[model samples]
Target: MSVLEIRDLHASVQVSEDELKPILHGVDLTIRSGETHAIMGPNGSGKSTTAYAIAGHPKYKITSGSVTLDGEDVLSMSVDARARAGLFLAMQYPVEVPGVSVANFLRTAKTAIDGEAPKLRTWVKELRTSMEKLGMDPAFAERNVNEGFSGGEKKRHEIVQLELLKPKMAILDETDSGLDIDALREVSQGINRVKDAGSTGLVVITHYTRILRYVQPDFVHVFVAGRIVEEGGKELAEDLEASGYERFVNKVGA
Candidate 1:
């Protein structure tokens, strides 16, 4: 079984020549394969910061701490290298690639992650199947990635990659953000499909408890001021929904 260990991870974003904005402050987390971890927090609590830092986005700098995938150093790896090593991030805002078709993008990403090209016939079939399962029109595959797509469509396409790429761990940043009710269910099912396969560890970062209803996370973490202040099971989510984050927010500010 694969394990991802984040120990005292402190990271910052370099916003200016002489200024570095601290985001993740001594965060520690550990998630294993087959485990679903939900990170719920108020905005600016460093939820997405943790996700981007883990994914090795150039904007975030890891000053002190360690991230390991089964004892292998993760912070040392380049962004693409991190991906090649089984880490995937479904961004809060998936970028629009104006020139790259979704079919080409998926295949190229798959090749990069797998170290070889997939046979066109089999790959096409797989891609078509994934798109259909995500409720995407087949023509969407021929269009430029995320361009001219609705917010919900972009989110759904991200899940299509998740289903096809099959990474060791996936960090989803607010995947439910712009999804409508039906789209929410569809995306949640796509996530559950990956989770049920027992291959990819899940770190679902969100601000609300709605997605948790369909995803059924095994652990819930309440992040505040860049640190996890509370950890519990599904009940914690229900509590947060009913009571909100005022208690935890006040504690963090106190």
Candidate 2:
């Protein structure tokens, strides 16, 4: 069974005068348990829009089609409800919340999604362990969320949340950007750890091939003009790497 399914999904963002316009057009995708899928495209291809739409971001309107989580209707649920239903999005640009400490944010989010507070002892221990696994300093937990964090640090924080929440399906929206070699390796290791826990699915959106070397996707999809136009195994990513997305852009009529 598919853990996440997006069938003929169409979404758009509103703007003055002529609406900003549809971003995703008839995108059909299915991610099963323990599978990792990569969507690669150039700028303005709607990869990030697909992630935000699935997570119920208010900016993206579901103009048509449907999204389901384990056969449950996701479009009918609120954003918070979507998170609670085992859907997680590690954003391309993680926003900073100045007043909230990382530890507090994780705890509150976990409690809200889990419908109960996590056991204090186990939660802290596991959180610390996960932090160490990501090569983050223990003191990071005390800092304000994403405040003063470098790009790599913010990306690592997203991985920290992924570890703590252990969502059934994680949509990583360009989590690879802005990382140095070492940091990318750490972040990729964190993702691998999450996959090792079992029954988890990953949808990783990236423009570069560096991160793919570590995480290794089961499928590669090419998005252009707000629609997926090509898909294949991992080699598709290598092909894009060798030849670039120009071929895909032409093929998709973008």
Candidate 3:
């Protein structure tokens, strides 16, 4: 059964009347437990918007349709409620919280999501382990969140949160962007580690094929003009890598 379902979701960013508007139009997607789906799209496509909408960001209004988590109405939930319901989004550009320590931020997040306080000793141990798994220094937990972090460090930190929280469904929005080859491998390994723990579903939104090579998506989708135009198995990603999305673009009439 699908853990996450988006049915004909329509969303738009409210902008000036004269500006180009409406990001997602009738987008549909389903992700099940122990499955990984990759969404690839050209520039101006609504890949990130889809992820944000699933996470229930207030900025993007859902014009129509529904998003459900394990049959629960996700669209009706507040952002915090959605997080507590086991939905996570690792953003492309993570913002810095200068005053907040990584340990404090993660602990609070875990406490909120789990509806209880996590034991400090146990939580710190788990956080350190997750940090090590992502090739990050143990001392990183003591520093401010995302403050002065390099691009690779920011992505790795996001993975660290993913590991610590162990959300049932994780939406990785451009998690592979701006990382060097080693960092990319580390990030993919972290994702695989979580998947191996069972009952974890993934929706990876990306523009390039490099990360897919490591993560190995079960289903690959092509998003164009705010809609999923094509979907197939792993081979489709390889095909897109070789053919450069031209075929898919023509197929979508874009």
Give the winner by lDDT: 1
User: Per-prediction TM-score, please?
Assistant: 0.98, 0.96, 0.96
Q: 190 in model 2: Cα distance from truth in Å?
A: 0.3
- Candidate 1 Cα outliers beyond 4 Å, as residue runs: none
lDDT score, candidate 1, position 85 = 95
Error of 1 at 209 (Å): 0.8
lDDT of candidates 1 onward, in order: 0.94, 0.92, 0.90
Per-residue alpha-carbon lDDT of candidate 3 for residues 100-164, written as tens digits (9 for 90 to 100) = 99999999999999889899889889999999989999999989999999999999999999988
RMSD of 3: 1.6
Clashing pairs in 1: none
Give model 2's clash tally. 0
Clashes per candidate (backbone, < 3 Å): 0, 0, 0
lDDT of 1 at 139: 95
Instruction: Give model 3's clash tally.
Output: 0
